[model samples]
Target: MRTATPSRAMRLAAVASQAYRRVFAASRLAPLLSRPNPVHRTGYDLDVVVRRIAHEAEDVVSLTLAPTDGYPLPAWLPGAHLDVFLPSGRQRQYSLCGNPNDRSVYRIAVRRMADGDGGSREIHDGLSEGDLLRVRGPRNAFSLVGTADAYLFVAGGIGITPILPMVRACHERGAPWRLVYLGRSRTSMPFLAELERHDGAVDIRPDDEYGPPDLAAILSHAPRGAAVCLCGPPPLMAPAQRIMRSVNPSGSLHAERFSPPTVAGGQPFAIHLRRSDITVEVGAAESALAAIRRALPDVTYSCRQGFCGTCRVRVLDGEVEHRDRLLTDTQRRDSMLVCVSRAAAGPLVLDL
Candidate 1:
């Protein structure tokens, strides 16, 4: 059976409707359909597969991570570090030691600390080559910036991870640089062979051979106006910081500490956890997080240096003595990082 044909007006109306829909879809109003380029994205959280893992030195192991999505990663600079979330639910930061130009993968070296926390031990023993790990930020708290006559890098033990990239950058730019790589022995230091390949002068002063490096002798090789970059344990960094000022007063000193910074003027304070109904006493030398951890052992925190906001808690009352470098003025009005910040006086009420 033959059906009746559509009227002319009805057919024209249908054609006009189709045209209007097409135009609207391509307009600015349809932003959801227009996907932004992933390359320009910043502060991205991703699950990356461990492509390779290798032992670098006596107690050091390096992990290479590749994006599971098979896309180029966000670009990073010399001193950028990644916040790695382990399968054990522990979060730790490791410096990027690989080439910055190569965006395909990131490389980080970890040294096992026998007496300290368990994060390093987890990476060295438990992490495998095929495991998937979540990571955030190639954020740089220690950036290699500004113009200098030359560069002097002092790396002790695993602190070489961040300064390795900075030395490579200086070599590529045809700038003068010297690295004083310090360790207990040559067998214990990572990247010793890699440093030899660079054109700059590398002084491998093992404590066994050199008998505790003389800061005066080390500074003698560096140019007068050179920028000094140092990262290491408190024993080495504490003295280097003092001598750098005396020897090269004209030079600029940039130091990064792996351990927690020493508390100078902190006074004893109290923190009252509102939800837990418990009060923790913060000692003059101990951090607020340390005190809280004793009362409540399951608190979440990473980078106890106050850069990561994992230990942040809402303040119910009391004036805060802010010491963190991450939070803004708006966020500081109601929040405080227990790892570094403390009460101005008396007791501080926290949301737990």
Candidate 2:
């Protein structure tokens, strides 16, 4: 079963919600409207129930979710994710690990981080099949584009989730593709055996890729127009980024920031919304998106890492200092993900 994209009425509902929020800002209704509960407008929201669970690793659990009637599991293009609203009132997003082309059941592989704040543990112990959840979206920020070109996918640990689907997409189309997987061990890595069956070139660096399967050698074999996308731990990503940077421009490389870069130490900045046309100052302690969202609660966004394109806004004037992984050359030319990016020099005026 596949769910349809948001209807025209849904967008209208969002507009209505926005208007209601502004009009009721002085009344008690403002707080009610700003609640992070649910925005029924975009059918991107759904109700789901766990159908089955598999322990892929010590901490990872692969869950199969069933969609409610009229809200069937969406036909997600491979490399998409379903944003789940946890009971904790925070929305947690997970990549669709099942066959992206297969619409029968939506599957997601979740690794429980030792440092995770109970979300992982909930999937392990608290959640079970038949437990209904307010699930929203079969969203894909890491979408597959330019399939005609050669491809190189670099996955580190959980980063494999999005790439798995992309590989399948490329293979079915007979596009040339390779993989550079970095993990701590074969047992701990999810979908290890599945990748081996791909029959294409695969470089698995369990601890360090220091041996014959060095990333340098693997990258040397890349064909022209070969796009590279890396997802994994920060340590693996940094080195991978350096290698990709040496060969390809940022446009040729696609990445989803699993974690925010800790690069801090910039003076306070300001951003002016060209659409909303509101200029807000951002302190060093605050992110551009956090400052924008707090100042304008009507903005609905998901990932704050700029990995997800939900927080994207167009730039009308001034230069932007981009540190996000979601935008393309076209997107970068006009739009910026406020979640992770900040001003390079002067205030950036955006078209929200």
Candidate 3:
């Protein structure tokens, strides 16, 4: 006979008991853990000076960064992003929008969110040209594949940064590609004049003029074996995902989000901080990073989506259900990005 699964209350109770033991263990080992833990600086390796800052749109600014050493920076693909370290020690990720062929400098666009977590605000108000900023990898999770028969690019609001480079690449290669750029208005959208040079078909739909976008009608026109790339907010992405899965299941869909991606199928778990000697209970609906921040407010993190590898911590105990694509097999053996990854079973002991 199969064993019955534990109910939600039972599972929570078990987790609480485990948390108690974890707390006791942490306190017992407090003296031994007093030694300084080595800092994990995976993404930040290069220093780049801000060469220029141009207002791309009403609230968007594009920053061009050049190396201090006067060397060509590391080459990046179309959809790669950088982990930018601000003067305030806060980290934020931005997509590279410049021409990849030009190795002298890297460019990224930022849209100021008045109610955001202060990163964009600091960037808009505090940053200036010639300011030195440390940055990390131009890593790619949404790369343009050459093998696709055609490409359907959907960019919403300020999501045009990554798609801009991909469109340029396709145009240069004489490949078939179409872009549907959407925004609140022409004034708020960036890079319209730059996109005008491309003779390819581009549909610019502003909500003020076009009302709400009929995402189904737009995506239904995707050609067979088309690679559909979407970068937008949840309102655009959610429906687009449902429509694509139903209408264009044969085609592949790759997406990037300005906000953290929704965490699905997560179960409640506990994170035992080895150094802090505290236990953070992770809710099924929230990420472990969110829970830890409630306990330790000053923890450093860049992309909460697990691509930047900034929130990675050593897993001292418990099996981890690794979720991020950024970490290698060897890295997964010992550490996990708490922003996305979670405990495989029981409670986790983290060297935070």
Candidate 4:
């Protein structure tokens, strides 16, 4: 006596009705919608002065920031990142590598991407000590959960920034933890000196010396009930995830990715904005959000990598090929993040 599951069309219609009702109810309840909702706001923008800037490695610089107004900054936990608004008008997210107990200043490290969108370049060239900059969030998308088991941490290149604090926390708590830090070379790896303090618990594998890490062997040898945390390039993280899934079925492996997963042979599609009365062609090389921005320049977006939900839009019609990791299954059925999602079928309609 099992009930039949609703079809995709039926599900979408039901969701649309619910969304319409919610919107209508909100319109009638003026008070509820009138006041500024801080939750919907992007983040609290704070002005901070750069206290110090030092080179941690080749093309890697660490910046220490303190409040310009002499007030205590918001507290952050391990694996937190800050959204820094650069002088070049580009907003980028950087992991907080400094000690969490220290309230006097916050520190973050940056690696200059030679072919990036100029954010890291600005941090390297346009910034200096005593310079004021705007920042938002000490948000943690990859937080360490409370557990009694030992921990295994894997970091690649600049990915070590987030894991550094986690290692420190484990050390302070007398918890069992091991770190496998990988980089292209020893001279290019940041926080080597700091990690060397815990030599017994750290394995620094420079690619030039050790080739690639033996991930299969590492995961196979992981302690039972150990929580594995990984942060690195997609190429490395993708394969690591597969190995982790095979060896650890409990899904204790956690990973944080800064870049969007690469799509191969993406099909070109069209998006119709119902409210804006516009239809934009999304080329295979361009994203839906980019196409929309060409017609409507004021659209809000952050973290084009698709981790942030700042560019979410309601879907009125068409199947979505969601590419983001942020949305839950329920949310994905009705809405899509325009930054990374695309239409699975021909033309998709949006409630923009």
Candidate 5:
């Protein structure tokens, strides 16, 4: 009594089954399948659990996140930010400060902004270990180009979050890099101990002691062909940018801003929604997005600071006073990130 050999169709089916199982395995496909859909509009779609939370400095807390299913998290690079969905129904972006090579955990440090939009306050007071969080993006609007001969990193207070990983990358690659970490004081500065490990490469400037960083001297002394990566208050970055332009005209300078561009004495404007057949008045004190939301409540938006580009709308007519740092000059020709931008002239017609 001999057993019959399997047919060709049977063998092919077995192979296909194995392949399917392998592809759907926890390690291989979990991270890919867990990625948030870019077109989801509402932003946060992936769920993660807070594995640990520790204070990095005064008013600064670091959160380590892992996928709720215990699978590997999505891989990210230096200067990438994660949009953290808070329990208070607000989404805020925080830079991923941990090693980019670590796929199992994503770390982000948040500084309690005493006078912020309340997202930071929620993260500080509300979120805890074991809490589940909805998150989107390890998105990189400010990424290291890796083409420079040398690098200069300037971080102020919580701004150190994004630059920390970049410094590690520079160290691993043995690239010529210098870090200027500035804060109100040494005690307030997060990652001061970590940065001090690279003593020769870092300059910790506490404003109380140093008054302010000598932007002119720092830029002038920077090695030729160096790219300066700055993440800090606009007041600090604005001067550094000017000095960089004068000292090394050909050098590249990139900045990551945590705040929206200031609009001084903005004139009142109106928005005309073409498809919805509605008009909303944008008062001098309020943003266009706020006014539009009153009429169309379901409009998707996140990071009302204008950095996320989630509330962006196509403009059909009228001039725009584009104030967002996220858009390129070319993009401002027709589209506007309504979170910060307002009308330069009259009623701006939007596709809605």
Candidate 6:
């Protein structure tokens, strides 16, 4: 979620409302604060064979993969996703929907969007059952921290993939959980019938058949310590989050973005490569990933947002103004995500 900034009007109103107060903690107020970004992570490659394929929705395809060498399947927690190295070296993230406990095969759901740039559409239009693709990761950006007093799973369109396993986890752990699955229509929704098995625990809101789904009402049911996880377009998350805050509180609601944040050019920073001893300039026109690859063509990266952590390198010196939301506060102080983060000042050194 993007950070919120206080407007001048709010400032003026606060000044007028608290005009009689001797002192006030306005800076401590949320209106002045910006929401922090979620941490990024890395995953390893596990090249697998596409054992089977099934169409779940008009734009969605489900794939069953097997280890090419009969290696043990990557152990994944519920609500995990994997990044696939597609044809032409393009990387895309997909949510895992198969049973985590049953480790024989890994299942994933991919939706071809109308605005999708070739990659997803290719999965729908060209990928076959026998085709093999380089697959990496079974990672969880939206991991269940095992803390929530109750769980509320809200999903939209292809976002349903991640939530499915969460619902299953809730059931397995005997945790109090509810799912409000939203889709454009019945047939267009993948795994609808299967989810209906949890009839009382799940609510299916198809846009074609139902009145507008009320996020506020649904959020009201979220008790304290309730962890609300959402995966979908930016719009779907905003309203749901609004209700989450109005009813529950901030930080109680969590979200996962398959895409990275927009690249707003910050002040130029110098990058010093200790291993290579090369310094490169990165600005709005270039990223550390791009600059490093330019000097060192062999550098590999998948998700540039630093979530995949593929391009992570050691920080030998200098203050790195971390912009990517993927690094832990501790890790940020020690290392750097070269993909999105840059040095806060000039002459930054990296142990590349």
**RMSD of each candidate relative to the true structure:** 9.7, 11.4, 16.1, 13.0, 7.7, 18.4
Reference-based lDDT, residue 150, model 5? 94
Q: Report the poorest 10 consecutive residues by lDDT, candidate 1.
A: 32-41
Regions of candidate 1 where Cα sits further than 4 Å from its true position: 1-41
Question: Could you tell me every candidate's TM-score relative to the true structure?
Answer: 0.86, 0.67, 0.84, 0.77, 0.78, 0.70
- Clashing residue pairs in all predictions, respectively, total 0, 1, 0, 0, 0, 4
On lDDT, the candidate that comes out on top is: 3
Residue 302 CA displacement from its true place in model 3, Å: 1.5
Model 1 TM-score on a 0 to 1 scale: 0.86
Model 1, position 90, has a per-residue lDDT of 86
For model 6 the local lDDT of residue 202 reads 90
lDDT of 3 at 135: 90
Clashing pairs in 3: none
Q: List clashing residue pairs in candidate 2.
A: 274-350
Q: Give candidate 6 misplaced runs (Cα > 4 Å).
A: 1-44, 239-242, 262-301, 311-320, 325-352
lDDT tens string, model 5, 1-352?
6654679668887678555534554465444453333222223256889999999999999999987655455666688888887886776788889997777789999999998767888999998899999998777777886899999888989999999999999999999999988899988999888877898999988999999777777777678888889898878776776788898777789888887545568788889999999999988878888889899866767766766787899999999998786878899999999988999887899998
Best candidate, TM-score-wise? 1
What does candidate 1's lDDT look like per residue over 81-104, in tens digits? 888999888888888999987868
- Ranked candidates, highest lDDT first: 3, 1, 4, 5, 6, 2
Q: What is the lDDT of residue 138 in candidate 2?
A: 60
Q: Give the TM-score of candidate 6.
A: 0.70
* Candidate numbers, best TM-score first, in rank order: 1, 3, 5, 4, 6, 2
- Model 5: lDDT to the true structure: 0.82
